[model samples]
Target: MKRWWIGTTAALMLIAAGCAGGTDAKSGTNRHDRHTSGQAMPAFVEQSTIPHVREAYAFAEANADQLQYIPCYCGCGSLGHESVKSCFIAGKKANGQLEYNVHGSGCEICVNVVMDAKKGIEAGKTLQEVRQQIEQKYGPQLSPTNTPAPPEGK
Candidate 1:
């Protein structure tokens, strides 16, 4: 009987620890957090769609203000430097020329947003409309209030 009581107590403790996130493995953080310390993006993305990728990056850079209204895709709680810059470097030369080696850590998200924005632009969707589409698609994962503001003017 005493052994049974001891076993039950240990089991309960384990269950409680797991529920409270006291286990050896922690799962709250993700790639975006890892990037916040100011890391660089990758150097190769889908080759066939460079222009589309560049457009998306351009859109994000142009709409820094709108970042406050959207979220990032890296699973980071809020927008960080890496997420924002990834948009700019998704697919372009370091000198802003055509470059095939361009890559970005958050390129997938940036690419998707950029593609959507380009489609919107081609469809005569204003910048605001395109931004709205991006927010609608990626907002839930982004931290609207945490995004940093851009320069003072333009």
Candidate 2:
């Protein structure tokens, strides 16, 4: 059916958009197709073919500052990850470039946590609400990262 084909095509396009992409720090044309920010994706992320892995990595990098307040519940605490952000970002370099956490590129629990946070935010939840929701959802069965609660009052 034509409708089926169109729906399938749209889904494929969405999947393709979430794929790991190469970057060109110079030329504009024929550059990174998924994200044209001119910054290369970490090799670890680029090695993944899973759309969610790539999508979550991109989201984690772009929202690093905010994610610091969101806890990741996957026992990453034992790994010294202080917050959800630490699952994806090890730290910044002297020049301000993010040092990617290779663990992020492979961990489904980390990616799912980030994705859930994003969905909550997009659905009009406040940061506090989002944090609480994630905690309530995962706290019972998993160990959470050392992320602190959102700064008191806003």
Best by TM-score: 2
Candidate 2, pairs of clashing residues: none
lDDT tens string, model 2, 37-94? 3456676787875558777777787777779999988788999988888988788789
RMSD of 2: 8.3
Q: Estimate each model's TM-score.
A: 0.37, 0.74
Error of 1 at 29 (Å): 41
The local distance difference test score of each candidate is: 0.46, 0.79
What global local distance difference test value does model 1 have?
0.46
* 1-154 per-residue lDDT for model 1 (tens digits): 9999999999999987666643233534332222222232223332334445544544444543443333345444333333434434333456654322243323565556555655765687555565567667777666432444333431
Report the backbone clash tally of model 1: 3
Which parts of model 1 have CA positions greater than 4 angstroms off? 1-43, 46-72, 75-86, 90-106, 144-154
